[model samples]
Target: LGGGMTNAVLALAVISWPKYARLARSQALTVRQQPYIEAARLSGCSDTEIIFRHLLPSVLSPLLVMSALDLGTMLMELAGLSFLGLGAQPPAAEWGSMMSSSRSMLQTAPWVILAPGAAIFVTVSLFNLLGDSLRDQLDPKFNPK
Candidate 1:
């Protein structure tokens, strides 16, 4: 509908929402069957209390990891949209736009095209690594033993 950064963000959010929703739903379902949840129920805790005190904490780690991992995907998607002229306006500085604008110079000043491409690669790789490290740090099964 609209163009520019806000539109790009909304598009990314729309694309991302379903995955996180499914993940949260599955995590909550698993947590719901845990002994602590059962104990909380036996202790007469309300659903809201149990959800906030138990389910949320139990599910937050995985969600954090998912969000971290999704960042790179979102960034790439936004960049692709910008490259296609469907995202950030001309005035806005975006790597994809930079690459797109320099496309004609590919045979002349290849660095113009390569620089943004390399930047995108490095940034995405860093974000993926960040997600991996976050998962390692947060997952209980990551014991170095």
Candidate 2:
């Protein structure tokens, strides 16, 4: 329970944190300049109130989209680490671990590698698709139809 899972969690956090921070920073900077935000500031809204009430709502959509996209990337990273013996430690059923352990079986039973490879491909593709759909649905420009 603590081995592979912990490694994966740590890897994912290390890999994904920077992208999220950048996204939030950029979004907050842009949203902070919007007319409503400026008006709120001029009208005596506290910084905390402006941030939580106004800034967050505007920036949250992109955060959601990026988070969906990050999930797949993080999973792929975990699998790659597992394949390299750095993640999802032995005995775990992660696709990368499966692929790594089944390396010797590649010649005799290609199906073993194929199954995990296919799973990783499909799962990552699905996550990317979900992220794209959410981006389109949430963005005002994309939603206009």
lDDT of each: 0.89, 0.87
Which run of 10 residues does model 2 get worst, by summed lDDT?
A: 1-10
Off by over 4 Å in 1: none
Model 2: which residue pairs collide? none
Top TM-score: which candidate number? 1
Residue 100 alpha-carbon offset, candidate 2, angstroms:
0.7
lDDT of 1 by residue, 1-145 (tens): 7778888898789877998899999999998998989999999999999999999987999999999988898888888998988888778899988888888999999999899889999999999999999989998878765
| Model 1 TM-score, 2 decimals | 0.93
Best by lDDT: 1
| Candidate 2 clash figure, as a count | 0
lDDT of 2: 0.87
